[model samples]
Target: MRIYAVINQKGGVGKTTIDVNLGYGLAKSGKRVLLIDLDPQGHSTTVLGDQGAELTVKELFESGSKLGIKELAQPARVHGEVVENLDIVPSNIKLAVSAENLAARIHREKVLANALEKVKGDYDICLIDCPPTLGVLAVNGIFAADRFLIPVTYARYALDGVADLFGIISTVRETDEFNYTIIRNGYDSRTKTTNDFIEGQLEPFAANVAKTRIRKTETINQAAINAEPVFTFDAKGNGTADFEALTKEVVGLDA
Candidate 1:
């Protein structure tokens, strides 16, 4: 299975939004998708309509915890209905403590990669929603992923800290096979000045940027509030179309 870690050290850049939506989008396209919520805040878990799950990603990093992905993953639900072909390893606030505890362990960064090896055959794709920090947990996610999906906002400082993230990835993996794609989320084309400024900032990484610009839309927020993906909330909306295009891009259908 191909693993993609949806990460960005800078918060509020639509990492969780893209991860959840992209997972559901791929699932809708007949791919078995596994989403791992690595954030202590559990936004991806809540967004997937799972709250207070009995088993979470926390067990994967805990010392002596034998729980694997199969035991922790459950069929993702939306408004109390199961979403077919989509599963989630939920997370909770307690994960913050687990992250702290993981720091002292040997080969902590490889824990997730080792656990994921057991279930590689079960999923077509695995999406890891990493937290907004460059800590042990994020390192584990990065180490486990085959590729990285970075979501950048329209803000002027959106590219800040991205270089550091890439530096860490280079140090940990040390291979050209590991690559990344940057998607611009909540893009507003009407604001030419802001768009131009952000584009200028992204000039160095322009080749890595995705062609699909997720437009700024209220439908996304509404869908999130309802604890469902855009496909189920408003399939005909631009939000759904944008994510569908993104899914194709990720799967190489748009290439």
Candidate 2:
């Protein structure tokens, strides 16, 4: 299975939105998708229609926990209906404390990678929803992923701290074998100047930028509020179209 971590050091950049939507889109297209909610806030978990899961991703970070991904993962639901071929390893706020405790463990960063080894063949892709920080939990997500999916906003400060994130990835991998893609989220075509500015800023990473831009739309937020993906929330919405294009682009990428 190919693992992709949706991460960005800066918050409010649509990391969880992209992760959940992309995973569901892929699953609907006949791919087995496993989403690991690695964030302490558990936004992905809640968006997937899960609440208070007994075994969560939090247990994976705890030392000496025998729980495997199979045990932790459950069918993703939307409005009380199961989403076929999609599963999620839920998370909770307690994960923040677990992340702190993980710092003292030996081979802490590799813990997630090791856990995923046993179930590599179970799913076609594993999507990790990482927290908006360069902490131990994010490190574990980075170490476990084969590819990185970074979502950047249209704001001037969108690329802030991205260099630090790249530095950490380089420090961990120390090689160029891995691949990463930067996707512009919450794009507004009306603001030509801001769009041009953000586009100019992204010139350095042009090769890694995705052609599909997730447009700023209220349907996305509405779907999240209803605990459903755009596919189910509004099949013909702009959010659905953008995410569909993104799913195709991501699947075409070599991991």
**lDDT of candidate model 2 versus the reference:** 0.91
**CA error at residue 137 for candidate 2, angstroms:** 0.3
Alpha carbon lDDT of residue 114, candidate 1?
A: 96
Summarize candidate 2's per-residue lDDT along 45-111 as a digit string, tens digits: 9888465877889889877798989889999988778999999999999999999999999889999
lDDT of all predictions: 0.90, 0.91
Model 2, position 23, has a per-residue lDDT of 94
TM-scores, one per candidate: 0.96, 0.97
Index of the highest-lDDT prediction: 2
Residue-by-residue lDDT tens digits, candidate 1, 66-92: 899989999999877899999999999
Residue 75 accuracy (lDDT) in model 2: 93
